[model samples]
Target: MYKIVEKEHFSENVVKLIVEAPMIAQSRRPGHFVIVRIGEGGERIPLTISAADTVKGTITLVVQAIGESTRKICALEIGDCFTDIVGPLGQATHIENVGTVVCCGGGVGVAPLLPIIKAMKEAGNRVVSILAARTSDLIILEKEVSEYSDEVIIMTDDGSKGQKGLVTAGVESVINREKVDLVVAIGPAVMMKFVSLTTKKYDIPTMVSLNTIMVDGTGMCGACRVTVDGKTKFVCIDGPEFDAHKVDFDEMIMRLRAYN
Candidate 1:
């Protein structure tokens, strides 16, 4: 059983958990994820590894309670133990000194982008991050994330905080004003798709993380298949990260809505 060592609410619907998983903590890299089940009969859910402490034997997961399983996971307390936990899955983000890197995150996407931005900064890249939400109350990790970023831009759709605009505006501004070596984007499908569209025009190399319906997380179920560059790829094994220029966003949106 995997125990929850800590839990903090990021928002009304988002919760952060520090889970006790020594093996995963020791070896996990940014962009990897974990699959967890609350009990013997609970549904499996995939969560991104936002941070890991190898020495402390813990890994952090930021979960947004958008559905029944996620809601259950969010409601779990500090001492609760999950019946099953599978870990450190998916390809890790390649960290390198890529000159100027821009990390764009929308809402809960900020959680997953935290580690990536930190790693990029540590690798000697100038990290500029964009955090977006509907309002100030929904924005998370802004303070913590800013420490790892050379510059941070905050955007809100309702003008309740920071600049009043979509995250795309910030992304476009940076691409136009600066020499960006790499752009990393993670968020809702629509947001990522639009970001991809915006960057494609500038010929900027952009990467996006995909959160498809995953089962077994090992590529055995074929549930996470996504078309990249017109070829089939599994998000579990091939990548949760892909070149934005090659991804078929429309197909991904349709697949995600299959049962909805």
Candidate 2:
């Protein structure tokens, strides 16, 4: 059993939990994720490892209570223990000293982008980050993200906090004013799709993290298969990260809406 060591509210429905998982913490990287089960017979849910502390033997999970499994997990208190915690799963982001990287995040997607931003900075890249949400209250990791980014841009759909617009607008402004060497985005599939469309116009090198449906994170389950460049790839094993230009966004959107 993995004990919950800490919990912090990110929003009314979103919470961050730090769980005691030494081995995973020691090995998890920028893009690795964890599969968590709250108790016996509980459904397994995948969560990105937002942060890790090897010395403390803990991994940070930013969970949004959107579904039954996640709701159960987020309901857990500090002293509670999980039945299972599996992973350091998925390929780690390849960090390079790429000149200027514009990292984009929408809503809870910002949490997953945290480690990547820090890694980019450590690799000596100037990061211009964009954090977008429907309203100011939904934005995550503003102060923490700012610490690692060279420049941080905030946008809200209703002008509740930062600029009044979508993340794509912010991306356009950055690309127009500066030469962005790399662009990385993570968000709802629709949001990422639009961001990719924007970057495609400028022919920028863009990568996106695909939060596809998954049953087993080990590639045994084919639930996370996606078509990229007309070829099938499994997100669990092949990537949660992929070249944005090549992904078939329409098919992915349809698949995501299958149950909805």
Candidate 3:
């Protein structure tokens, strides 16, 4: 049993949990995720590792209660436990000193992007982060992300935050003002698709993290399959991160709507 040592609500629908997982805490890298089950016969859900503390033997998970399984997990209290927690899975993000890097995150995607921003800054890159949400209250981890980023831009669909625009506009604004070597985007499928389009115009190398319907958290299920450069790829083993320009977002987005 993995005990929830701490819990905090980021928004009405989003919760952050710090759980006891010493092994995962010590081994997890940026871009790694875990498959969690609430109890016996419970549905498995995959979540990206938001942060980890080896000394505390804990790993942080940020979950938005978008569905049944996620709601169950989010409803748990600090002392509650997850019946199963499996991972440090998926390929780690390739970190390099790639000059100026712009990291774009939307909604709960900001949680997973935080660690990457920190790692990019540490690797000797000038990190600029763009965080977006529907409104100010929906934005998570602004202070934490800002700590590692050289500059942080906030975008919201409504004019309730730093800039009243889409995340893509923020990315274009930065790209127009200066040279950006790499762009890392994580968010809704539509948001990522447009972000990819925007970056492709500038010919900047862009990477995106995909959240697909995953079962078994292994390649055996074939549930997380995606097309990259017109070929089949498994998100579990091959990547949760892929070259944004090469991914078939339209097909992937359709697959995601299967359950909806």
Candidate 4:
């Protein structure tokens, strides 16, 4: 059992937990995720490892209380223990000295992008980040992201925070002025789709993380299937990350809509 060492509420609906998983923490890297179950009877859910501390032996996860399992997990207190916690699973983000990389994150997506941005910075890339939310309260990790980013722009739908617009607006501002080598986005499917579309026009490479309905965290279940580059790939193994330009967004979006 992994002990919950710390917990904080990011928003009314979003909760962040730091768990004691020394092994996982020691190996965790950007873009890696884990499967967590609240108890023996609970269903396992996949959550990205937002951050990790090797010496401290802890892994941080940000959970949005969207459904039954997530809501249950969010209700646990700091000292609570989870019945099961498995991973630094899946492939870590491919990082290189790609100059002028733009990382776009919206809402809860900000959590997953934190480590990715830091990795890009470590690789000697000028990391520009675009953080977006529907309102001021929904925005998270702005200060943390700004610390790693060479440039950070915030956009809100209600004009309650920094510049009133979508994240794409910030992307457009930067894209118009500079030569962006790559763009990485994580957010709602619709947001990612549009971000990919926008970058595709400029011939820049775009990558996105897909939250397909996953049962087993392994590829055996065939549950997290997605079409990329005209071939079927399982998100569990092949990717939670994929070339955004090659993904069949229409089909992916349709599948996601079914959950709503």
Error of 3 at 193 (Å): 0.6
Off by over 4 Å in 3: none
Off by over 4 Å in 2: none
| Alpha-carbon TM-score of each model against the true structure | 0.98, 0.99, 0.99, 0.98
Which structure is stronger by TM-score: 1 or 2? Answer: 2
Which ten residues in a row are the worst by lDDT in model 3? 209-218
Tens-place lDDT per residue, model 1, 1-260, is 78999999988899999989999998889999989898778888988899999988999999998888888889999999888889889999999998999999999999889999999999999999999999999999998799999999999999999899999999988888989999999999889999999999989999999989998899999999999999999998998999999999999999999947
Q: Who wins the lDDT comparison? A: 3
Candidate 1 yields a Cα-based lDDT of 0.92
**Which lDDT value does model 1 have at 194?**
95
Task: Note the residue pairs that clash in candidate 1.
Answer: none
* lDDT by residue for model 3 (44-107), tens: 9999999999999999999999889899999999899999999989999999999999999999
Candidate lDDT values, in order? 0.92, 0.94, 0.96, 0.92
lDDT tens readout by residue for model 4, 124-239: 99999999999999999888999999998889999998899888888989999999999999999999999998999999999999888888898999878989999999988888
> What is candidate 3's TM-score against the reference?
0.99
| Candidate with more favorable, higher lDDT: 3 or 4 | 3
Count residue pairs with overlapping backbones in model 3. 0
Which pairs of residues have clashing backbones in candidate 3? none
How big is the RMSD of model 3? 0.5
